[model samples]
Target: MKKSIIIAAIINCMAISSFAQEFGKHFADSTLRLDYIFGGKVSSDGKPECQVLLDGLVRTTGWSGRRNNLVSMPLAGNGRVTVRDKESGDTIYVTTFSTLFQEWLAMPESREVARSFENSFLVPMPRRLVTIDVELYDSNRKKVVEMSHNVNPSDILIVDRSNVNPNPHRYIHRSTHPERAIDVAILSEGYSVAEMDSFYKAAEIAVDAILSHEPFRSRADEFNFVAVGAPSSDSGVSVPRLGAWKSTAAGSNFSTFYSDRYLTTRNVKRVHDCLINVPYEHIIILANTTEYGGGGIYNFYTLTTAGHASFRPVVVHEFGHSFGGLA
Candidate 1:
């Protein structure tokens, strides 16, 4: 079995290399983030269908993904985004991701009414104008929705977030090159300005727990870590069940989806805005609460309570969903 697994990995590497040869011919070295609203409703046939709407584009510096797998995706997730050359319509870059919106569709609430959720994704910037196609798939791996739009690299409307916010951040681990490493940013959610020291201490504990894990421990040198000290007005997140609400940095709250232990935040755009000045491919938010609750969304963000007794294990498990992309 080990030999078979090794052979399969080798074949995948060769295929990625073959596809990467076309990267330079079509795309540049920067990154472009496409934000969208993913909505769904029951059709006339009584089956659910999804739709995608454009939410603004932002250009950021340094793409931290693998250059070899520019056009081929190793995982066929619930959603995919593809970039193609405008003239020839040849696919130049492709990536797959899962979303919380898809999961909500399966819940009992979705069956009673229509709903929408905010979603975002990143792609390698093309050198010239290109067509971006976003696709959503159902549980049976069938394509249910698709939308396409054109993007010009020199367009003035694209927001540039390379130097915004410029908040103070510390690097726990620094890789030699970002382009070849996995970049992760840890953001402070509920710690006040005076409690930054505590936030830093919690960030250290989180980093240690992640690095002590299996694959990460063996490949420590291939990752970079940054702690963004985003201060808040208060020191604890909101517990809606207790009618206790505090002004946190990222607007996090408990009682998500009507579950008291399921902590989450709907302000995704604000979370990204806080890290505008930092370079990251993944994000983890540390909330300053001793409650045993947290949430994670694949390819989106991870939120975990830092002051709980089971903090280490729970945070690591949530990271598996947000960063490792495991279900």
Candidate 2:
């Protein structure tokens, strides 16, 4: 019995050592951003199929993901991204995330009309050439669509976003080490340049609300916060139900999906574009409006109205959807 227990312990240690070695061998200290279009269309035979197309690649500095779970996922999500060494064809990294595209798939509009959504996600940059496999799953956890693309680390076409943006920002809460921090970027949506100070104040309230929560409260030191002063042309967001429109930084708008209270934006590319040069694993958009509407998507983005009376609690609840990946 004693010999069996000792042998099991040795095997576990060997497995952990091998896992760490794989992460160091195949990945670098940088990050690779993979942009893709996730869409769906019905065929002549009445079968719906989801298609994936490579949009672009971005090279960014300082990967902020877990190094221990190199090839395993803690949860099974609607979508998965897997990176493998090209030569060995061995998976070096894997992660699961939910997408807004998956939510749109169930809408009635998708049945009759073909639609595509912009999706951009990141993985640890490979030291050498790698093959990226993207998989989409159904509600039953069955794989529905799969696509593989090869990536060369030395590709010149890859956009480099390591340089910081000229826009002014302030840290609400900062961890000593970024690589070990859950970095959240708070972006201004409808606040103009003159109202940036107000945006910063709202951002602080958001950081405090998140850190005051149960699990996050205990792990406050493991998180970092930054407020990006993305000025808008107007001072408030667009509310089509009231025939009010404003040119926001992230183009956020209310009346999403024809519901007056469902605030969301399909301009995902613009939202990400505004995040250039920001080191963030999560995003929160603060709209300069007093409306009682907001939206959140798992692993995508969270948005809340900063001028609302319940802004503090709403922001925290929306963040639970974005950061915690809660439904």
Candidate 3:
């Protein structure tokens, strides 16, 4: 979870590439769009999130509930801006405030660089999806486009072709039944599989208990599992100063390993492409070591070497992220 130090620090919000287009160009066309549902303005009564967010815009944009002449009003907590055609009910696109805005928000210390227009994602919304249908008009109050979803804030993962403006948008894929795959690579740093049985059982029980919850019921099919080897030399090894993570006496070095793992894990999408043996979406690495240390990521997975079976459960639990994106 403490994988990418940079991603962990950034402020969370959503917006697309540009101001004038449909949402089809951002991701694979086979996907659908789901927006963040802003609370209060919309209800979660099984309603799509995009509607809640867009509906809020119509209500607040100084339009006074009027669809035409929809003036652009940057909401107090607004992170993204949207524009729609009054007649056609289409959304133009999404963009970010200059890098200065990110810095100004952080003040004395901000890590974001000022991005230029060229680096922005600007495109059109897609052909089909949920339709809250709030259209925007031009200066003449002519209906230009309309948007189907303006959502509430609860984050979910789903493909959105509604806005092709891509700057790395997030999506939530909810499923009524959960499915997952796990690959555990068992390596022995200094111990054997038999010695780590206790830890293995502990990990398995923990994973089983964790999956007992209901939230993941809808989206678990993407799960996967795999395993590899960990030689004795790596049993209690700790990575110190090599990356953003630090080593601790009580598994501190393991933290550094995670940062480095993240450096690679972050690019896991490519890993699958390179290794014909690997799956593109998710994977679980189980090291058969004794010392305590392991971690899991949203799209990647890992576990330290435990006993003969100590890491089996660890691999399953961590796979939740690489396969389910639940974390």
Candidate 4:
């Protein structure tokens, strides 16, 4: 059994804000009075009670059916949010908000672990029995119902080498004229230009598939791509590995994987030798063949997805992360 990769396809709503809750406090830019009804892992019911406190947030008020994961209402309002049957759409036990209206705000300090942004809950290699669910209750109630919905980690999060954090002052040490003469180093431990050309051809095919969405048209300029030749063996030493393939969007900074990993975690002894060695922020790594898996990370590395698919997208996606204004 390989490590169970827990990826959170955490598509945080754009206008979200910091919220403080127990364990995982979620807050949106706007108050959400409505409870996400879960119906047997497929559908659920909603009773929009004009929960006054959540006026702008809650959509409507009404009664509901059976569901376990219910969002009790109005911190005392008589409304329930429940999950339904995956097939029948039958409600289980209705849920609502509890009377204890504990509102936790996100302070500037807790940005790193803020639950607002989707995170890859690293359940390292050799994954354990994984069973995930959601839950919430009314303000006046004291119980929570388990959501029927199941979320997959690989569907969202990526892992490269987000281990070493650069010094704050490093920003001051900028390259005299960054762009025209940026340090363009290729981290191909084993490929030649001709081989890389083939890899790029593979990458192009895959990347074109992802760009079909409308957003990619205007945001096209926000992307970059690179190719690596001989991949290194330091994967075990520098960062974590994936048991299976994974995927991520274009603007992610997962380019470091293609770079050589000499002393990744031991502090940027030689920033250049490590991932920080490059001038261009973004990077793309096209593994030569139909390998079994890949990984990605933020600021310090790269991610591997779509091994069975052509190499084009894998490289483009990595490049998207590396140069997508993440720095």
Best by TM-score: 1
* Model 1 stretches astray by more than 4 angstroms: 1-22, 43-46, 176-179
lDDT of 4 by residue, 188-208 (tens): 321233454444444455446
Per model, state how many residue pairs clash.
0, 0, 98, 80
Q: Which regions in candidate 4 have their CA more than 4 angstroms from the true location?
A: 1-194, 206-210, 226-278, 305-307, 310-327
State model 4's lDDT.
Answer: 0.27
Ranking by TM-score: 1, 2, 3, 4
* Candidate 2: C-alpha lDDT: 0.80
> Can you write out model 2's per-residue Cα lDDT over 1-327, one digit (the tens) per residue?
343343233223212322355667888878888999999965555455799899999887776666665777545678899998899888888877788778777666767888888888878888899999999987788887999999998999998877756367789999765555667899999998899999999999989987787666765666789999988999999999889999888888898767777677777777777877677778899999999989887668899899999998999888876665555
- In model 3, the runs with Cα more than 4 Å from the true position are 1-253, 257-275, 303-327
Off by over 4 Å in 2: 1-22, 42-47, 164-166
Worst 10 residues of 1 by lDDT: 10-19
The candidate with the higher lDDT, 2 or 4, is 2
Which candidate's lDDT is highest? Answer: 1
- So what's the TM-score on candidate 1? 0.89
* Better by TM-score, candidate 4 or 3: 3
| lDDT, residue 201, candidate 2 | 96
Evaluate all candidate structures by whole-model CA lDDT and list the values in order.
Answer: 0.80, 0.80, 0.29, 0.27
Alpha-carbon RMSD, each predicted model:
3.6, 6.5, 17.5, 20.5
